[model samples]
Target: MEDKRNIQIIEWEHLDKKKFYVFGVAMTMMIRVSVYPFTLIRTRLQVQKGKSLYHGTFDAFIKILRADGVTGLYRGFLVNTFTLISGQCYVTTYELTRKFVADYSQSNTVKSLVAGGSASLVAQSITVPIDVVSQHLMMQRKGERMGRFQVRGSPEGRGVVAFGQTKDIIRQILRADGLRGFYRGYVASLLTYIPNSAVWWPFYHFYAEQISYLCPTECPHIVFQAVSGPLAAATASVLTNPMDVIRTRVQVEGKSSIILTFRQLMAEEGPWGLMKGLSARIISATPSSIVIVVGYESLKKLSLRPELVDSRHCYQRFTDCYKRLYQLQPEMTQRIYDKFITQLQTSVREEISEIKAEGNLEAVLNALDKIVEDRKDQEEPAWRPSGNPEADLRSALVPYFRQQRDALQRHVRKQEAENRRLAEAVVAGRQQVQELQRRGQARQQAWQALHREQKELVAVLGEPE
Candidate 1:
């Protein structure tokens, strides 16, 4: 429903600062020339009854030529030329939509379906009436023939004898059925085209993505771009041919309604009637798809070279700068290392005083632990300087780190010595106290023995004990 394809086309055309419409329109029309004759023949066959005006594609071709001459094959040329407005609109819209969402969409399939359906929705609304007129004109015989239905717009009574020019058809259609008549098969058209576009885009995108693995370096890959179009078109055409037949029936005046048409086509011509002009449609779609896509992409790429070149050049310059930085001389790298070490020394020297004042030798030890923990996690040898500036810087830093390590070890040793002396004194005092207790206990024991002897002696005298 958001059929915003035109937005992207307008943007893309503006990107190159040139008009893409002219080239796009021309390429599309030219390719259409090859397929138009087939299309006309197919349309004529679709509009007729069970083998009435023509039996099949071969018969249609012969009859048109015999009745209308060389020009008979191009009956709808003028109307189709007018119809190109819608065709171009569809193409532009699709391009714009695809371009608009290219960056955000992860799946090519979804993008394709969305873009295709959206563009068709808009373009079909504008062009179905034109399609009506063209098909009418296409189904018409030449001035010389006599057919069962004496329709207007043709010289003989056999052709679309309702009107002459494009305006005449419009006027006549308006006179007969008014506005609604212009959109006679609106629902059928939507059903036919929406799914057709959705199917076409997904198939196109799927094949394009698969093909892209082969076009790594090119922007509008010539062969890949060209081949991808037809493959995608052919696939979509086959799948949607039945809907197309139904749509054609519903649109052409005097044909049955959609439900009745399907039944009639199936009953009269079999299921094959639903695919009446499949080959012709395929032929019509493929080259036109190719031409439109190739021309659009080619123009886009051609205009983008300068910007791409500039970007690459800027990237190269950045790379060069990095290379020079990495190639700095050993002396310069050593100066850098010295400067770094001086900063570290200053910071640590300031923190050392606070640590010492707080009597937190553990803090210094923790800092040393942290420094060791900061070692690189990778197994690669550090700096790897075989004339590498980074390696040279690492080499210069090694001596400073060793000195710091020695200083921290010295501090740890001092703390350990102080701790050892305190432990010795504590042990000495404990020993002295134990000796005193031992002497006291011995004296008490002696006194108690003497008392017992006396008590025994005095037991006879028992009182003082």
Candidate 2:
């Protein structure tokens, strides 16, 4: 009891609500970006279910590059950024509320706890629409038959999708439900966020306090701050997993409520449906949050006086990072595409080899022709003449008849062999042409995807002005 009181007293003295919020949000963004690839894998796997979309993380990633050729993995980033901003606002509000409560109330810890809980509720309200958009965008498959065009290519912008892209999806929702369509899962989102974030932040603070008790006395408050943010994020992720699954389906499919989604999951996949992607979410969320927090905190610390760091400098740094990443993206995508194509080619070549080895009739005829040709040089004339000139002529004439018969037989066999070979060659040539056409189509699709991706990247980087 005494120790608890002492820890509370220390917490009251040491905690800075504003700094923690900024630190936490910064960390969140950093972690989110770093693990963006993993999150993408998880989303694809979830959408694919039984399909050959991807086998596992690595296999799916390889397949994405091979099938859609690289840009396919990051199709909805624009909407994602918008969604992330919504998430950040939630955290920011939570911190501000905590600070307000702490300042107004003598019991800082209790007020902070209340503030955190309420903030989650508010943030959920704001974030659900964006979440709806993001999930709808994520669940799409290559060539899944959306609207009219049947989009194909990469998440960067091709493969197989319904005609309506992200904007189209939004329009459909609006057409169906007006503004309300964007908030289809509002109730479920609130329910999930309130308990999830409320539990997460307080639990994180408690854990950090405990860790601090065990640490050396000389360390700064920043270390504890860093440790607490990740612990909070991870704890929230695991505890809220069922809700997340519910949330994802609700947002993407735009079903009724969380309960309906849950009921559907239970009916289709039993109770495990609620945990459909817990492993992936946990794997992606924890470390990703940690990285985000650590990097953000470090940057915040280094950039501590905004006046000195300057908004211009921050923008410049971000621009440089974006530029470098954008430049490398093509090379990275190409490497992945090349690797998958090589695998697919190997598969195709093996199939062709098997067909040819099955003793194709053409092959057999060609072998027979070779055998006959070898015997041609060794044989003497079929007819010969000797003694009297007239007798020799008659005898030679007899051999000529025999030779004609042999020549006729050989000619018939040769014609048959030539015909068979020609047929085989024709089939092989047709296959090659078809394969080339497919490759050409894929390349054209890839070029368009690359162009669109570049445009988006430029937009995000804000183009020097």
Which candidate leads in TM-score?
1
lDDT for each of the candidates? Answer: 0.68, 0.60
Per-candidate total of colliding backbone pairs = 12, 19
Q: TM-score of the candidate numbered 2? A: 0.52
TM-score of each: 0.57, 0.52
> Relative to the unseen true structure, what is the C-alpha lDDT of residue 168 in candidate 2, on a scale of 0 to 100?
73
Choose the strongest candidate by lDDT.
Answer: 1
Per-residue lDDT of candidate 2, residues 1-465 (tens digit)? 111112211122223446655665666666566666566666655544343555567776786667655555665555666656666666566556766675567454566567667877777777777766656665555656321112234454455433347767777778767898788778777776677756765776687779778767666655666677767777886677777767666666656776776777777767655655555666676775455445544534453443433332332222232343324453332333335446667996886677578957577668768877876786432222243435533443466568889999899999999999999999999999999999999999999999999999989899686
TM-score of 1: 0.57
Model 1 lDDT tens row, 1-465: 111110112235334434355665676677668888998877766766667777777777787778667777887677777767887688668767877776677344666678889899988898888888777666556443221122344455444333345566567667777788778788888988898878776666567668766655344455665777889888878888888888887777544378887887788889878878877787778777786567666655444435453443332232232344324442343344447546767988988878889999797799777765676675433333364555654565587678889999999999999999999999999999999999999999999999999988877786655
